[model samples]
Target: MFQKILIANRGEIALRVLRACKELGIQTVVVHSTADADAMHVRLADESVCIGPPPSRDSYLNIHQIVAACEITGADAVHPGYGFLSENAKFADILAAHNITFIGPSGDHIRIMGDKIEAKRTAKRLGIPVVPGSDGAVTDEKEAKRIAGEIGYPVIIKASAGGGGRGMKVALTEEDLEIALQTARSEAGAAFGDDAVYIEKYLQKPRHIEVQVFGDGFGRGVHFGERDCSLQRRHQKVWEEANSPALNAEERSRIGGICARAIADLGYSGAGTIEFLYENGEFYFIEMNTRLQVEHPVTEAITGIDLVHEQIRVASGGGLSVKQEDIKFNGHAIECRINAEDPRTFTPSPGTITHFHTPGGLGIRVDSGVYSGYKIPPYYDSLIGKLIVHGRNRVECMMRLRRALDEFVVDGIKTTLPLFRDLVGNADIANGDYDIHWLEKYLAKEE
Candidate 1:
């Protein structure tokens, strides 16, 4: 076991890792930007270091500074919680060269899975189900058109190196494919510094469900089951729930076994998510998240497992403690990401939180890093905390979430609490019939 670990993240996730480390008897050092000197994670961590100023590239994304902080703090391992450099293969390699463990998948796996096209090839080789798509990046308009023709019309063009819906465009019919390809390539180049784009058959009104998988270094793995993250806005997940009401018994057996086999085939290690877009009873592989997801707490609520501790133990050369047969999915869990943003315009509202409160009860859990006096910084991500609720079933879960979202509050700045209040109370959400586009159209109708 590592005596100390450095948390290379900010906001609530940083605090989440810190608390987990404390419970596992591992001291944690937090790396923060100059703007986050007074951040809550810094205060709660055993040690804190200022990496750089406000900009992410010079600070949180600065690989050398994070490495230096670990060296100075005697942190033998670094946990890249969710974002920033968490999925960067080079960052993992850098840590490895320094003899410091990265508490996730190995660098080789990261490199292979980081690229969408390459990951598809890997999945293709392993007999894992993948959506029909281009061979790889389409370098010429002719290649793009040829692939589009073969895949049929209305294909989705995506950046090979992108996530979070940054560089994506849908081309309906052949006439639109050329413009969509050029635009998507430009966006990808500008956003990710890679002009490479891939094409895939797009699923209409798909439910984004992902299987939570954990693997030890020895090719043994198990899945904790799936979470429906279809409650999303602009390709970013706002709410997530486990034991998706849409999945049946046979579907559960199929997806769970497939996810486990996929992880084992990749020789993956630590905690990673196998994301799939399900529509009309067909589940197609979308992508994989190479680190702990922000929605992990919901999985924990259902499975009653400490994923953070599991990640630590696995990184320390420990084999998986649980097997596929031993894992059982139970109950239902829901998570609402309480962000510091406007509910109407979806803009950042960075300021002091004057009055802050989170809900608590038998099945409610709040993961947060801010207090009433804490200032929400403009330079970082808007996520403030995650409000999670667990129940015996989906009906009970929705009711619990309704009450929890009502009780949760924040003042002195705009918040999505109002948006959530309306969402939780909606009949469609309560009835479990909402799709990916349902919220956007519903909110548009209100406007």
Candidate 2:
């Protein structure tokens, strides 16, 4: 086991990794930007170092400063808690060259899965199902049009290196394909410095189902289950639930086994998610996240597995402790990504939190990094915390989620709490009758 681990991020995820390290009796070093001098993770870390000023590029995203922090603190391993450098293959390679461990998959695996185009090819080669689409990057307008024609109309153009809904456009007909391709390429070049884009047969009502997978880097792996992150806005997941309400035991088992086998075949270590778009009776691969997801708590809540601890163990050369058959899924879990934003307008809300309260009960868990007087800086992501609830079944889980939401409170800044309150009571959300596009349509109606 590592004696000390450096956390290379901030906010709730940083705090989450810190707590996990503490539980395993490992000392922790937390790096923070000047804007996060008083951040919760820094305050609670065994040791803290100020990396640089905020605006992430100079601070949280600076690789050299992070390496210096690790060297200064004698941190043998780094747990990048999502975002920033988590998926940077070069960062992982650099750490390894310095004799420091990155508590996730290898740089090779990260490189293969980070690019959407390559990931699709790898997924297909691994026997995973994928949507019918172009074999590789559609470079020219002619190639884009040809793929769209073959796939039928209503194709989607996506950046080969894109995420967060950027560099993506949908064309309902052949006439719209040109504009969609041009816009997607332009956005791709601007956002990712890569003008490569691909085409896929767009599914109208697919549910965003992602399987949670873990590996030991020794050709061994296991899958917990699936999470339904269908409730999204602008391609961002707002709410997520484990054991997707849309899938049954047979479907879940089938996809989960496929993902577990794929990860094992790749010799992947630590936590990763194989995301898919599920519609009717088929599951089509969308992409793969090479690090722990923002919505991991829901999966932890259902499986009773401490993923962070497992990540640390596997990265430290310890093989997987639980076998696939030994792992059991117990209950339904839901996670609400509580962000500092206007519920109605979806604008960023950055300010001091004057009053703060969190709900606590048998099935409710809140992971937050803010206090009453904490200042939410605008330089970083708007997320403040996550509220996860678990219950014996879906019905019980929703009821518990509703009760917990009523008790969550934050003041002196706008938040999306009200939005969750409404979602919990809506007939569609209540019955799990929602897709990736459902929230966008619902929000449009309200506007």
Candidate 3:
């Protein structure tokens, strides 16, 4: 086991990793930007280092500074808690070269899965289903048009190296394809520095389902079922739930087994999520997240597994602690991403939190790094925390989530709490009758 681990990110996820390290008797070194001088993670870590200024490029994303911090702190491993350098293959290689383990997959795996185009090819090769469209990146207008026509129109153009809804455009007909391709490529080049784009058959209404998978690098793996992140806005997940209400036990088992086998076959290590677009009894691969997801709490709640703890152990060369058949799914769980943003406009809200009150009781958990009087800086993500609730079933889980959301309180800044409150009360959300487009449509109606 690593004596000390450096957390290479901030906010709730950094705090989350810190706690896990503490539980496993591992000391922690938290690196923070000047903007986060008084952040909760820094306060709670065994040691803290100020890396740079507020801008992410100068601070969180500065690889040299982070590596220096690790060397200075004598930290043997780095747990990049999502975002920033979490999926950077170069960062992983740098850490390995310095004799520090990255508590995730190898740089090779990250490289393969980080590229959207290559990820699709790898998924298809691994016997995982993928969307029907172009075999690879399409550059010329003629080839783009040909693929769009073969896919029967309504095709989506996506950046080969993009995420979070950027560099993506949908064309309902052939007339829209040209403009859509141009816009998508432009956005791709601007956002990712890569003009490469691919075409995929666009599904009208598909649920965003992702299977939580873990591997031990020694060809052993297991799955903790699926999380339904269908409730999204601008491609960002707003709400997530475990054991997707849209899928039955059989479907869940089938998909989970497939993901687990794939991870084992690829010899992947640590935590990874295989995301898919599910519709009408079919699942088309979307992309794979090479790190822990923000919505992982819901899966942990249902599976009785401490994923962070497992991640640390596996990265330390300890094989999987639990076998595939030994893992059990227990209950329904829901997670609401409580962000510091206007519920209506979705604008970022950054200010001092005058009051912070979290909900408690059986089946309710709030994972946050903020407190009363904590100033939410404008330099980083506006997420305040995550509110996760678990119950015996979906109905019970919904009731518990509603009660918990009411109990959650934050002041001195706008938050999306109101949005979640309204969503939990809606008939569609209550019945889980929603798809990837449901949240946008609901927000449009509100407008």
- C-alpha root-mean-square deviation, each candidate: 1.1, 0.6, 0.6
Model 2 stretches astray by more than 4 angstroms = none
Check candidate 3 and list the clashing pairs.
none
TM-score of 3: 0.99
* Reference-based TM-score of each model: 0.98, 0.99, 0.99
- Output the better candidate (1/3) by lDDT: 3
Regions of model 3 farther than 4 Å from truth: none
lDDT of each: 0.89, 0.95, 0.95
Candidate 3 local accuracy as lDDT? 0.95
Displacement of the residue 17 alpha carbon in candidate 3, Å: 0.4
Tens digit per residue, CA lDDT, model 1, 1-447:
999999999999999989999999999899999889998889988899999999999999999999999889899999999999999999999999999999999888988889999988887786668888887888888998899889887899999999888789999988998899899999999999998999999777888889999889787878989988998888889988888878998998899888888788777899999888898898888788889999999999988888999999999897687888877777899998988899988899999999999888879999999999888889888999889999999889888988998888898989888988998888898988877777778878988
Q: How does candidate 2 score on lDDT? A: 0.95
Per-residue lDDT for 86-111 in model 2, tens only?
99999999999999999999999999
lDDT for 91 (candidate 2) = 97
Tens-digit lDDT track of model 3 for 266-337:
999999999999999999999999999999999999989999999999999988889989889898999999
